[model samples]
Target: MVLTPSSAPSRAPSYAAVLRTPHAACPFAAALLGRLSYGVAPLSLLLALKDATGSYSVAGVAMALFGAASVTLSPARAALIDRYGPRRVLPPMAGLYAALLTVIALATWNPGAPALLLGGLTMAAGACTPPLGPVMRALWSSLVPDRELLQRAYSLDGVAEELMYVTAPLLVGIVVTFTEPAAGVLAGAVLVFVGASALVSSPAVSRAHTARPPAGGPAGPRLHGIAALRHAVLVTAAVGLCLGALDLLVVAFTERLHQAAAVSWVLAALSAGSAVGGLAYGAVRWKSSSRVRLPVVAAALGAALLVAGVSPHLYALVAVVAVAGLFVAPALTTAYLIADESVDAARRTQAGAWVNTAFNAGSSGGTAVVGLLVDRLPIALCFGLAAAPALVCAAAVARAGARRPRTAGTGAAGRDAVSGA
Candidate 1:
């Protein structure tokens, strides 16, 4: 009863056309609405937790556990969607998560909540958070069967996500200014509950067998989608590492210049560049395949960061960061595309989740790794060290290509590789 993808288009299509795919807008919009909570939830919880516990240390610990649970369980959650379909799995997960957020908000509403209780609640909420992003990407594969169109869809998705993160913080900021952080948490809960509800009820879910029969057999004897995906994961983790490190590094960079306010401007510039680059990357028809492009984009990101370490002025640093940002969304979008195209249908959500998990884990790791380095090494060298992973991944993928050319995917992934990444 699995619903297969539509036939590939005869030619490349635009982003608008990708959205025009039958029943796509409904589920896509719903998923984004649900995912926007992702942008809002973390900061809200941190602030709310801090208010209730009245201890920054306790709040930090709670947030750490929350993130740990979410990231660690993401692939597991996505696997459920791949089996049961989003309609069947997403609703219950979203409900449980939303309910937990409600409890946390109530506890934090007036402060004085026990630290133990707050931490446990936040972790529980995180555990039940639905795999909305992964589910949406899997849906995209079915909705737009063509690689080019799918690329545009993913690019548009990445851009939207980037904007969501930027905008969500501002929304939370306004809320906290007027009321309390718990209100922000309440808003996040409502968004997910409503979004998941609407998304699951969409005709898109009802019309198709979004679930695949359990993925059968190993991908191949050796080095196929599995190996290719491994490359993407490693490079993505590397990108995550640099980005995670950049946040703290930028702060340190600005501290030296005595202009702490510039941090926002620099980071904003980075986001702006990513949106622009993702859009640009999507519009052009590529002559090279993502298998070839992943390493290049990863390296380009790393190269930009390397150059960023030496920026001489605030404007120069912002420009360099924006340039580095250019590769961020495109690199991530390419990685997601790799994950989507590399696996069979049943494994699509899990595959995408793993890439996501890698990026987040790498970011956390980067933050920790750079924290230790800043004390021992010069700032410029720390930047170089942060850039090392992407450069190394690029080299490794090229070396592997020389030794063997792997087949892309098996069991219904029929698309060919296209253009440089």
Candidate 2:
């Protein structure tokens, strides 16, 4: 099913056409809900922990533990999905994760609860959160086998992700306003459970499972050996670092302006820019290879951030930040494309999960690094530091693209040729 220059259409299929395909709706809706919860849960955790302990330090520690657990455990959980299929893996994990979240929410209300107990629950909950993003992306290959259409699907998913980020925080705010911070946690838990259950039940996802090989057959290459996958993970991690720094920078900048109330709008603007960019990128039929396009886009993103570093006013900062975010979803969607093309079908979920884990790790590290620098250095200098990782990502992508052969095709044949090398 590899689509070479000869096979691909002069114009890519419309996003609407891709969406109209049979069995597309269920997985999309389910994944959307699950991803929205994924967006909400961490902030909800922070708020809940802060409310319960009455100390931001304890809350930070709990969040750190939760993030660490997710980064540590995701690959193993994804491997389980790859081998046993989502039907068997997602449901049970989702249920356990939901239960843990509820327990954590209730514990947040107990004045006498120990810090150690709360931290453990947070970590466990993170460890158990379903690998919805990876699973859904993996399903796209089977659900829409056409390379061009699949690219469109990924782009649409990326745009949906931007919407989720924009909406989730608002949802959390509303929940926290009407109820307690712990109520936000409970709401996120419910979303995860219901969304994951519906997703796993979808026929598209059910049919997309890769069966385990017979016990005696040769296993696939070690994760490190898969150059495309490794590169995708590294590039994604770098992007995550940029995102993490930007998040803190926005907060610091807004706080400095004595307009903290504008933070949400500022962040929403960035997400909106990304959504627009992703839609545009997906709609066009690009003549260039993904390898070539990836670095170019990364460099553009870095340059935008560098300009943002020197912005003189809140309006200028917002403008540059939105411009920088324009490339975020496109770059990520391309990285996912690379991972999908780089690994064996049986190992795709694992590779996707590892990429996600790397991104999360980088974000956690970036936040810690940027938080320290926000007070110590000038705001502009902090932004320049944030742009550094994006530049590194560009360099890494350029190097990887140079090493790989040029391919107009990005299907089974293209992937097989790459993997075989």
Candidate 3:
């Protein structure tokens, strides 16, 4: 079912068209269900630990352990998926994660759970957490070979994930209001297990598996095709670093204005702008390949952030932040698209994982680094400094992308990549 431009939708593909691809809806929904756990489980864990330990410091430490394990090991988990295929690997991982969460929930259900126990179990849970998001992105590359439709799909995914995070905390709020926060952890356990079960059942997942190389050797062929991923990961990290700084910078901006209540609105605007930008960017029919487009979008985001701190009023800052947000999803979407193009189907999950890892690691770094600078430097100047990474990284990517030659056909010739959607 390999599809060419003539067989696929027009240059500007709609999200609806992307979803309508054969056997797409069910697995995608299943992946989202699993991903919802991701949005909910962490917050629930934080709350549960806080309730159990009666100490914010203890809760923070446990949560930090969980996040670090999850982010740091994402690529390794994805490598397993890449080697064994999602259908084979995702279920076991999800099952283990759900079981660990159940144990965590029970341990915290009555409070007085030992900190040592909680920390160990949470980290173990994170380590076993299935790489659902990366798998789903790889699946998209499998189901939709047409690059245009795939772009639309990734954009749709980023927006959906954004919404999931926005709503997940509210779900936690409701659960905790009525019962123990430990109950929220139990709920997450249910969600992920059910989602993974259903996702692996999809016919589309059958197509996700590729011929694996012999074990005991490095990913021989898979590693060869992924050279282009270097630039994608680099720019993605820079974008993530900028975004991580923005969280604190926005807080500083609000504090300076003595308008703490406005912080939520500014953050909301950023999310909204990103959602809008993602959809728009996906629907556009770009002639350039993603290798070139990646750096361009990264640069746009950097430029917006560079001038955002100069805003004199809350309203102005919000507007500029919103504008900066416009580039956020597009940059991520484009980066994922680059991963899709650079890696073959067998290695696709790992490819996505690497991008995710870089972005998340950069975000952690940005938050810590920006915390140090917010006190010493002017807020505006801090904003400018934050922009430096994106600008500098984008130039590096631009140079690398320039040296690479464009593909002759649909950008999937050698990679066995996207066919249609």
lDDT (10s digit) by residue, model 1, range 281-385: 887667556767778888999999899899998899999999999899988988898887667776788999999999999999999899998878888898899
Cα lDDT for residue 16, model 1? 87
Q: Give the Cα lDDT of each candidate.
A: 0.84, 0.80, 0.83
- Stretch of 10 with least lDDT, candidate 1: 412-421
How badly does each model clash, as a count of residue pairs?
7, 0, 5
Against the true structure, what is each candidate's TM-score? 0.92, 0.90, 0.91
The whole-model C-alpha lDDT of candidate 1 against the native structure comes to 0.84
Q: Report model 2's TM-score to 2 decimal places.
A: 0.90
* Model 1 segments more than 4 A misplaced: 1-11, 208-214, 217-223, 406-421
lDDT of 3: 0.83
Candidate 1 residue pairs in clash (backbone atoms < 3 Å): 286-419, 287-419, 288-418, 288-419, 288-420, 289-418, 293-421
RMSD of each: 5.2, 3.7, 4.2
Worst 10 residues of 2 by lDDT: 412-421
